[model samples]
Target: MTASRPAVEIFANPRADRSAPRPGVLTHEARAEAQAAIRAWPGYAPTPLLDLPGLARRLGVAAVRWKDEGGRFGLGSFKALGGAYAVQRLVREHGGDVTFAAATDGNHGRSVAWGAKQAGARAVIYLHAGVSPGREAALRALGAEIVRVAGNYDDSVRQCARAAAERGWQVVSDTAWEGYREVPTAVMAGYSLIAAEAVAQMGAERPTHVLVQGGVGGVAAAICAELREAWGADAPRFVVVEPALAACLLESARRGGRTEIPIAEETVMAGLSCGDPSPLAWEILDTGADDFAAVDDAWVPPAMRLLADGESGDPRVVAGESGVAGLALLLAARERSETWAALGLDAGSRVLLIGTEGATDPEIYREIVGRGADEVAGTVAR
Candidate 1:
């Protein structure tokens, strides 16, 4: 018999105050500025918003729309939007000879490196012990000088900040802390583009629920801000999902403030294995987000397979380990009637999910899905 999937941990944020003012970082002006600049870049294009009628039927929902970011800017992840856009802003403000630095599990580093290359600048990426070698190799291929840190993602963030400050290099981090908010603010603005495109692709058909994966909570908060801005009181109910092993966002929601958890073990969902929550992201998510959920690693592989298999005539999607967290949480939650009811999920509900990354690491993708990304995408014959 197969090992049973763990119970999903759900938290209805008690402090969610929708009447509060919008976070300053996510203003309309900032988002528009970032969008215009990013669009002007040579390879900018909107990723597809796929209709998943199969999953909708399985979950008894009216519809399920998936924003597939696997092929975003040919970088294989949605992260191509944020870090690269931030790098462009920095390069324009500063000079072309500057060095940009950041901490990453993989995708963000690649974006920063690619941006640096485009601007004729330098990139220095910091990685923790838990990050995969394939991710490191991908960054190196983009011309980033890799620095291995001792602890988890948060630790790597600290080291990256310190080294960048000491060496006079710019830190283009997605998370924000005291006295450090501008670059991260711009990063979040760039991320809002994903939500903007999704809303446009959706047209007049509005979704009732949005289930988004959270790492440091940057992307989740960005999407929430964007949708809420676009639709106001008519926006979808936002749900943030993270790995159970490193569910700092959930813990923060429970405590009614920013919180950090000790990462004793790393989840296979590498990008979501972040122990600390971003303060900038939390400001928006604290009020904008309706729910937070933690899903176990056991659900990841199956979610990836389900997308790859395209059950019930759904289109095949190349979702990576981290990319499937939102879907994994949905699958786990629907198994429990109480949890399902509490989330307000019903047959009439229209839900949206974000597939944040593709096969960022091909070896791991093959091991989990039993096929290459191209094969799952029908680009190669099986």
Candidate 2:
């Protein structure tokens, strides 16, 4: 099946000022602490930074590198780092039989549940009606008590907050509200580990641009902070990508603050279908991110299939619908010369894209990519 090129809306951040103090909540010291703590966990190792030469050639770029987080802690997403680290830190600071509660489209909740279990605490996860049954089952497998909300992702978040307050459960959320910022801050800090690994893996070869998929923007903020610290004034151009249907970050950038969009429909990129920009994440991305781009959901499946059918000796990648947003946006933008130039993309540009997950929902993944992750991996092995 041939997928049509996605339509994109690009907004350059007018508030992008990288002046005196950095715009991020996470400091280098806090990131270091989170990294050390996470490294102590069992099965903690750096995920791969794959060089996609064929893609680079096809896209008329110098290089296209993918930071694959599919196998991160075996959770199938990079989110495994954040919530788990925050839970560990929470347990260390405030002892006792605590319970963690939060809302998720899928991946973050699973990570939080796994973290709570590892920390000898309990977890309750709230999912919106759109969350797939497979995702709920995954959360249940991680020992989280599940509550299904009738509304969208934002509604689920509100429900989780109320339940946590009433039940005395600490919220280990990735998004931050007015008075509830600490845990989410810690979660963002933990995500800096990805940037650190990617930088080290690249060695002396720095990327010219980075396209990060955004939900509430925690991961993008974390990456921005790390890159800013490492490259100072010369950090690579950062673009936050989202599903057009649920582009809170893009809308927030256009509005010049933390803006919430009322969700009218669900996007195929379930994980990126967040209606609100995380206040904590927005603090950083407002200034640190150069541009915000939104893509049609139709682009996702084709992006996933492209990764699964690796080219020019590049190993197959098992990116989920949400995970392929960065690549989809890149492809969409490249089709328009003006958009490509606006993003500073050229033949010499070295681009970095994050493959945020494997087949987290195997059923949906197979439907999109035409094969299971394991099957693709087996082919790669041969």
Candidate 3:
């Protein structure tokens, strides 16, 4: 398929307050605490940081590194850290009997359900109409009671909130709204575990750029906060990439505040098809993110295929639609000389892209990459 070129928006975050007394949403202490807690969890291990020398040569960059979260806890997404950790915290603070609820396109709901089960709590997940059956089935497999809503992802989030309020269930959401900051704060802090691992793995070598996928901006904010804490004034330039159809972060950055985009159609990037920016996330990303770029859905599949097939000698990676967004944006940017220069990307640039998921939806994965995730993983293993 001939993918439409991505539209790039380069912005310097003027409001980015990298100052101390960091936003209460996520702090260095919270990140360290989360890292310790997650390390103690069963099967908790740092995901691989893959060096794609061949891909770097092909893209004409000094180096390209991929943080592979596809195998994170075997849940197939980095969200396993966020929702599960938040649910565990809530269960420990409140009680194991507390019911948890959240809205998700896919991964977060599964994490919530898994966390609830592990914590001996009940979970109900709300899904928008656009979520595929495979995704819903995955949540059901985790024992979450599913509620299908008629609207988009934001609508489902609202439904989840309403149901949580009426039924007295605790909402373990990744997105934040007014009077709903703490849980999402915890979620974003949990995500800082990823940044911590990447930083440690990079050792003395730091990338010049870090491309993060933008949803409600939780992951991007968490990564930016953690990187700033680690690298201080020398942190890599952080870029946020999202689907063009649901570019809430881009819209919010353009407007200079938290803003919502009305979703007219669903983008293939189910995980990133968010209409609203999380207020808690915006608190950090407003100044933390360096640039925001929106890509067409068509760019996603080729990225998934490229990772699965392994460019040059890079090992095959199983990144899903949402997981491949950063790489997709990077690939798209390389085609435009002006966009590449604006980001300061060139032969001497070292870049890091987070593959936030594997084939969370196996059917869609097979269709896009022309092979199942298991097949690619097994091939890579050999």
Q: What is the lDDT of residue 63 in candidate 1?
A: 95
Candidate 1: lDDT of 52?
A: 92
lDDT of each: 0.90, 0.88, 0.88
For candidate 3, write residues 1-382 as lDDT tens digits. 2244345455555665546434456877788888889999999889999999988998899999999988888788999999999998998899898999999999999899999999878999999999999999999998999999999999999999999999899999999877888899889989999999999999999999999999999999899889988888788988999988889998888888999999998989999999899988888888888888887787788888988888876898888899989878777777789878988898999999998988889999999988887799883221
Query: Under the 3 Å rule for N, CA and C atoms, how many clashes does model 2 have?
Result: 0
Window of ten residues with lowest summed lDDT in model 2: 1-10
Put down candidate 2 lDDT per residue, 75-110, tens digits, no spaces.
889999999888888888877489889899999998
Q: Cα deviation in Å at residue 145, candidate 2? A: 0.8
- For model 1, residues 186-263, the per-residue Cα lDDT tens digits are 889999999999999999999999999988999998998888888887788889999888899999988888899999
The regions of model 2 sitting more than 4 angstroms off are 1-6, 379-382
Full-model lDDT, candidate 3: 0.88
Candidate 2, residue 85: Cα displacement in angstroms equals 0.8
Give the local distance difference test score of model 2: 0.88
Instruction: Give the poorly placed runs of model 1, Cα more than 4 Å off.
Output: 1-6, 380-382
How many residue pairs clash in model 1?
0
